[model samples]
Target: MPQFSRHSRRGRVMIAIGLSALLLGTSACTRLRTHQGYQVDKLLVDSVQPGIDNRASVEGTLGRPSFVSQFGEQDWYYVSRNMRALAFSNPKPVEQTVLRVRFDPAGNVAAVDRMGLEQVAHISPSGDKTPTLGRHRSLFDEIFGNIGAVGAAGMGGGSAGGPGGGPNGS
Candidate 1:
């Protein structure tokens, strides 16, 4: 039986401890980065009286919105998110908040709404096959379809051009 010396066993223990420390250190370095939108302070947001605050007051309090309504200028949105990722994986949203401010026709703040992560929707694609129009052709059909149809007439390489013909008039 091969017996390990006392020094060799101690060295092995030290190596194992070093590897464990390295793994723990690396894991500790994994941090979540918060990507926030227009930094909307809670106190300022709360102070924004709906009917009193107009576009100018809202802009001054919360700064410009993250996005305005695409259809019209009726709604403004302030969005914030926290994303986390490990190693080479894609960063995913850990938290999301969307504050919607709706304006009445008079351009005054009509309503103030807030949505949390619970409102987030995850959409999964249906399948690998994409729906395409027209009939699908087999590999054999694709390969043989253009076999002898290379240089025909108006295709620019037949015997009806000005370059060469069958011993007839130019």
Candidate 2:
């Protein structure tokens, strides 16, 4: 029987504890995979046929959409993104897909479009102030800017309810 001495056993125990801590510490560097928004399946996305499928049918097949257009046109958008992150940094998109489904007047599918990360707008703000082509004005100028421009102090401007306000100065 190989019996370990007290010093040898303590050394082995310390080595084991060190290895365990090293394994745990390396977990911080592990790449984390995450998903956001819609989970797209190639088969399901390809199955949606335009001109034949309606909103209900598309919803039934692909589930609820991520967002609906609120402006001039009513369209459905399915946004899917795969993100990767290390321990404590902001997650960056590994893969992103934006699917736009347009509808006709009768609610039938007009078209189906799919796009990738090319649609992403990386807008780093230039500064605290947004750049504009207009002339710069101070707080006092802005507050009293329009006060004297519209009508002079005693000019007979035909206003709605004042004297000389009407077409006939009655």
Best by lDDT: 2
How much lDDT does candidate 2 score?
0.89
Model 1 over residues 1-170: C-alpha lDDT tens digits? 23558778889999999999999989866875757666657898898888999999999889899999998899999998888877557789987888999999999999999998999888999999989999799999987876678566665455655665435634
In candidate 2 the C-alpha lDDT for residue 169 amounts to 81
Query: Which tens-of-lDDT digit does each residue in 12-85 have in candidate 2?
Result: 99999999999999998899999999999999999999999999999999999999998744599999999999
lDDT at position 80, candidate 1: 86
Whole-model lDDT values for every prediction: 0.84, 0.89
Q: Roughly what TM-score does model 2 have, to 2 decimal places? A: 0.68
Estimate TM-scores for all models: 0.67, 0.68
Where is model 2 more than 4 Å wrong at Cα? 1-4, 126-170
Where does candidate 2 have its weakest 10-residue lDDT segment? 150-159
How many Å off is the CA of 137 in candidate 2?
18
Error of 1 at 51 (Å): 1.0
